[model samples]
Target: MHDWLDEEDDALITTALELMEEQRKEQNKTAARGQRAPGAGGPQYSG
Candidate 1:
């Protein structure tokens, strides 16, 4: 029914938001350390 669909949608939205928040936190940590995140490519040091 409609209620079940709404619940599924809400769960999907919540999961998406949580993933975004986690990614943001990881990016912040990477920035603070001046290192590239995994799968971001490139080297962390010049020599």
Candidate 2:
């Protein structure tokens, strides 16, 4: 645990957190758009 983080350190941490949040939002959007049923397969098991 760090008791004291300078202004520069704090700013970098804040910016990184914000960037991660944005990337997560973008990924969620992409996943939501791809929730359709899967395509048919050739064969699962052939006896």
The root-mean-square deviation over C-alpha atoms between each candidate and the true structure, in angstroms, is: 6.7, 9.9
lDDT of 1 by residue, 1-47 (tens): 47999999999999999999998777566655665354453343332
Model 1 pairs whose backbones collide? none
Q: For model 2, how does the per-residue alpha-carbon lDDT over 1-47 read when each residue is reduced to its tens digit?
A: 56466777999999999999998777565555554422232222222
Pick by TM-score: which candidate is best?
1
lDDT comparing candidate 2 with the true structure: 0.62
Which regions of candidate 2 fall more than 4 Å away from where they truly are?
A: 1-5, 37-47
- Give the TM-score comparing model 2 with the true structure, all chains together: 0.61
C-alpha lDDT values of all predictions: 0.71, 0.62
TM-scores of the models, in the order given: 0.67, 0.61
